[model samples]
Target: MARILIVDDAKFMRVTLSNILQKGDHEIVGEAENGTQAIQLFEELSPDLVTMDITMPEMNGLDALKAIKNKAPQAKIIMCSAMGQQKMVVEAIEAGAKDFIVKPFEESRVLEAINRVLG
Candidate 1:
């Protein structure tokens, strides 16, 4: 299992994601409510991976992803987004995100994305 950091604006979404990742034996190193916080946490904790939301206040996930990748090029990240965000997902992939997962979460998809990125 890997250490993971989860970044999302929704409290329930964060909890749901944390629960799922925890069950897989991944230790949650930290959580962030927005992208700025995520970037800060990422620098401080340097977890094995991060699950980042696409939309957030005070700095979107894509911006944070760029910031993180710029500083730590080896960092592994999975973008979390909703349907109809294909363009942003493509941008994230171009910016070095390892993979992505759609919201209104499915357990299998989430797990699959995690494993694929981490593997």
Candidate 2:
């Protein structure tokens, strides 16, 4: 099972993700409400994977993804975005996100993306 850090501005999103990941048998190492906190947690926890929200207060996911990658090129990150954020998703992929999941997430898709990235 992978150790994961979940980052989202909404508490609901974080809880939803945590439930899905825990059900998948992955360990949730930490959760962050914004990019700044995400970055700090990433350094502290060094989780196997990260689920990062794109639009967040304090720093934003794209910037956080870039920062994490800069610090650790092998860091495995997956961008989480809402509908109509395809452009941001693309940018995230280019910036080194392993994959992405749309909001209002589906359990199967979430697990699929996590497994794919972890593999």
| lDDT of model 1, residue 107 | 88
Q: Report the lDDT tens digits of candidate 1 across residue range 4-73.
A: 9999999999999999998888999999999899999999999999999999999999999999999999
Model 1 misplaced regions, further than 4 Å? none
Clashing pairs in 1: none
lDDT of each: 0.95, 0.97
Write one digit per residue (lDDT tens) for candidate 2, span 49-119: 99999999889999999999999999999999999999999999999999999989999999999999999
For model 1 the TM-score comes to: 0.98
> If scored against the real structure, what TM-score would every candidate get?
0.98, 0.99
- As for model 1, its CA RMSD to the true structure in angstroms is 0.6
Indicate which candidate wins on TM-score: 2
| Deviation from native of the Cα of residue 113 in model 2, angstroms | 0.4
Error of 1 at 114 (Å): 0.7
**Residue 117 lDDT, candidate 1, scale 0-100:** 85
